[model samples]
Target: MCHTGGCCILRRNRAGRRMTLSTQTTAPYPSLARACTVVLILFATAVLAYTDRQVLSLLVDPIRHDLHISDTQMSLLLGTAFAAIYGVAGVPLGFLADRTSRRNLIVAGVLIWSVGTLMCAVAPSFAMLFVGRVVVGLGEAVLSPAAISLISDTFEPKRRGLAVGTFFTGIAVGIGGSILIGGGVLDLVRDGLFAATPVAHWAQWRLVLLAVGLPSMLWALLLLVIKEPVRRHDQVFEENLPPAAGQNSLFPILRRMAPVFLVVAVASMVDNAVGAWAPSLLIRQFGMDPAKVGVELGLLLMLGYGGGMLAGGALADRFAIWRGRNGKIELCCLAVVATLPAAVMINSHSASGVMFAVPIYFALSAVVTASGLSAILDATPNRMRGRAMAISFFLNVAIGAGFGPTAVALAGDHVFGPGAGLGPAISFTVVVSYLLAALVLAAAIRTRRS
Candidate 1:
């Protein structure tokens, strides 16, 4: 390979054309082993980010019981407060990711969110807890765009699905790990384990929060060793030009890719809604215990969410390789359709319902989700990707995760009146959500095809 001062490297582009791309970061064109390590670290970081977020749901009963708040109020802590601020912070952060050191951005997010997590542990009132969640959201806002953009730079488009999907497994793993690890903490707190220690006055829920939050501060230091990977570029589309400091034109690019972004937001609403509310439904309707359900939820989420995310990436790759651009979208549409039955069955009363239905719903969800994100990465040029992802983050979180759970809680509290309402609430949410997702996904397929 021809190179300049051992800094610049020669590489082949996708179009059977050779192109020489610049290496701007510390370790340019890093080895596959190094890249894999980067992915794994980011994966772990993703796990931490999600675990911090998901702990609230498992601790929901305890928090609400102690806080004396309604489900409606709790829903804000879970989704809106976090998602909204995360989305708001992400746009500018996305612009930064495009221009500066994504490693720095990522690490900063980790430290900030870790601090926010600790705030949740020490918060004395409902208002304070809500404020803590907002900070957590603000801190977490940096991860999606920065991390996804980093992954995009590390891997080629053909393999980006699997790479991004693998990164996303952090979502499942963190979520499951939260329930798994938090369950143990929940047990200890109940047994007065932490109370017996110096922090005798601490509540069970607060202890659980502290257990997860405190470790994250030290873990953020691990990321400092990993140098930022070289930013990869498309052979045909890129000029590899740096943006003028203030010249952030993300809107035009977003407008051009409106259809694809629409699918991301709509699809995420359904996917995140289920995640936000699934556990409460199980506990509320099935009369399951928190610790017991945590174990089950952990195992099921790992299998269902982790497997689904991985499968979706691999499937998107295979379909696109075999068919064409629209092949990826078709696979996405099919995955959306596949979830419909399981979505409905999740609310069923049969013993078999919880056994089979829950996993199926989770698995098919990522099939839809992974492809949508990968599609966004596919549509946008590498230079503009950070902003693109930031926009998607805003829409998906604000509309999807942010609102998904709140909508369910409201429906249950007002429409269904608490007890029997959760099942129907979930049923109505998923069925309508998946249907809307399918219609939008189908439209995206046509737009991509044309």
Candidate 2:
């Protein structure tokens, strides 16, 4: 007999006796208040992860002076070193999430990355620092696949866009918070607040890394309190079935979702490229103080990118109801196209002009990013969500994080002539990446329709 929360089925056992099969073995759906709390914790954890990850951007000049590294080498520290491990580890971790306690996985990941961050603070050489970053990447690789899978099971399918969107805002805040906090810490160090402390002899950049890394350890303990929701079953039979070949593997799903994956990869490439270089661009081209740029850029990102995540989430939910599968991809395409113009504006000669353009660029990028993720969740079933997210993470870090910063640096050092062409190089990278993203998203739309 059917019931409110679940159903019971009558079955014949091997002995030919009647049996009742109940689908209520797992916990019931969480209360609204409980769900909100889960999302809040996830959001905060994401903020911490990204803050630790992106803080290096503001520390670029300081690190270079001490270690004598080139832009390309720094970019490797920024992108490839971290991404190589992050991308590779994500797949196995993702599958583990599918079979294990996601909460525990997240807690362990948080502790790991936090330790890695501390390692970066003490590293005396470039190679050691790169190793530290790789460790950080390994820890962070556990978050998205597990977190997204958790959220998907926590909320109903229809509301998932908003939930996922809210979680991603942590990225906006984390990115912004890193700069804001980094800059504030730098100011304090310069003002002699730590002059009397034991860390007085430490470099200003190392202190910043130490400060950000410490909080995450405490946060990891807090994550221990969150309960893991039961995994949801697919409502449609077809969704639960294997491919036409009857093989239980991820290959068919991956092939089917290639265009969607490419869209995410391309979007991440531009987003990371812009983020990694914007601080440097301002310092190099406009000669603004790093502290001041941090405060300003941090505010812009928190407001612009954060707002974009919320709006994109709301819009994606609405679009899903209004237009079905095609809606989210359409939104992505529009956002990608809009991003091109704002990207070109990064080359603006005046500081004010660039400032005006940056928030708009970030907001649009957030729209694409947030909506694109929602689309992926919409397309995949619950059983495969973790691995699906892992594939996306692998591609995102491998292609986007792996190459984004290096591409900009290479263009600056080689094509634009060492120190002077950062502004133009940023613009060039953004335009090319977005153009490719738009094409892939268009193809994704067509594939969905057919």
lDDT of 1 by residue, 131-235 (tens): 999989988898878987788778765565577778878865776666766676677677876755777688878888887888888888998877776775442
Candidate 2 accuracy as TM-score: 0.90
Tell me how many clashing residue pairs each candidate has.
1, 0
lDDT of 1: 0.75
Q: Which candidate is the best by lDDT?
A: 2
Superposed model 1: Cα runs more than 4 Å off: 1-28, 155-161, 191-196, 235-253, 350-352, 448-450
Query: What's the residue-level lDDT of 407 in candidate 2?
Result: 93
TM-score of each: 0.87, 0.90
Model 2 has an lDDT value of 0.82
